[model samples]
Target: MTDPTGVTITERHEQDGIVMEILEWSRLGGMTDPAGLPLLALMRTAELPVRQLRLTLTDAAVVLEAGALQAWHGRIEVENTIPAGRLLRRMVGSALSGERLFRPRYSGTGVVLTEPLLQCLLPVGLQDETVIVDQGLFLACSGGIEVGAAVQRTGSALLFGGEGLVQTRLSGTGFAVLQSPVPDSELIKVTLKKGETMAVDGPFAVLRSGSVRFSVGKSAKTWFGTAVSGEGLMQILEGPGDVWLSPLQPVYDGFAALARTLGPDATEAAESGRRR
Candidate 1:
């Protein structure tokens, strides 16, 4: 469906869950000003992942993390979801979540298309539920959902286990979309009963937000045992809900492996180089 213009959005590969938004080549006016010819040629074969979400005016408001918006049709009012008083906290939370500090809020009826991304998009429905996401995994969520930081049980836990000192936490009744490098097929799901616990080796956890308590603790009974066992500090998930684990996160895999290969000092320098 074209959005009242030459831009046509359609689900060309519905079975693969891919929606294609094609901007008619004939409508490319100044688009040919620079390297337009080659760009137009490349656009023909490019199978992009465009997400289309329909909005209802009086229903739930759609909230997109900063810059997630690509195009939209209908009357949608834009605003910042962050409260004026909680700006500082939000900033800190953003730093920990490895996401942009400001998220844009859109409300009213309309259809919005998100820009194509390399990662797969996951649509999650929550009814008074909670989910903890990996750092940088969040894309957008419903305005009724609460966004904040999910902190580790302790500082030591934070350093050895998680992506960082904090991760993104979503709660309340609504739907959410997360970007994950791992496909849904490979993401293994394990449900834990009350008083049950599981230990993970690395940052294999994708999400364990449903009635799950995540922490970092000794791999064994004693410090000597842990050190000799080469287990170090491990992520211990205690639960009564679900846990999703991915084999890898391509975004963080290289860097994390490099950090492990090098010592602590070299890892810091490597991180600094990455920042630069």
Candidate 2:
């Protein structure tokens, strides 16, 4: 598909990187709950080098476009029982925007854009020897990563294994895009309070928020294993894959569930109902 500017947008997924043009058809008020509102609808109308993007929807669309530091296009997939709303909230958090910039999250798979964003207040990168900790599961990536902190191990293997949390103090100013066990955009940034510990899935799960003191801890109970704590901002995300939002899976499953519950002709019915 092509946009009014003649930019051809197509859907695809590759191990490398892809560029495309995206046209958002709606705006979401800064509402945490993403239900009872219209879905964020768009078609792959065009593909371009995507030198720069402009979000025309209401609220802070333009801010998001400008604030976005990096953008990459690719395919994504998810298969889990997580709620769609929770997953989408995590993606919006990934963009470091409180506004509703994405739709509900779901399981399945598809293509989408993956981005790494930072808060305007923090430095562009982590300080030398600064440790970034992962409190949930270990993520494996082939990309070379600057070691921020020395690696450490805990007594309980489950609490510190690849399925648990990993911690590393920062050594210098740089960023590491560690792979996630789940496809999501939310990167939680939190400060650790004295004696405070946070258990979460990964560092990418909490993209960019204010900093506090934090450390990795174990599950409070059986199911509720790890979580992040402290008085600062902490991000949470959900979707497909291990890292980044699996566009195909989340978007496809979200809409599919909506369609099934509302009926196959829901989108059309929505238009008709709006007209009435």
lDDT of each: 0.68, 0.31
Candidate 1 residue lDDT tens string, 1-276: 335453444312211112222222223334536534443433333433333443333433677767777877677778875778988887876665665677778776665666656566666667888899987788877777887777765777767775677778899977777887666877888999998999997887888765798888888999999999987888898989899998666556785577578756654464455457
List candidate 1 segments past 4 Å from native: 3-60, 91-99, 248-276
Give the Cα error of residue 151 in candidate 1, in Å. 1.8
Each prediction's TM-score versus the true structure:
0.69, 0.27
lDDT of 1 at 224: 91
Candidate 2 contains a number of clashing pairs equal to 60
Candidate 2 local lDDT, 90-203, one digit each (tens): 455435423223222211122223232111111123333233444322121111123222222434433433423334322333332332333333333344444444444333
Worst 10 residues of 1 by lDDT: 11-20
**Top lDDT: which candidate number?**
1
Among the numbered candidates, top TM-score falls to 1
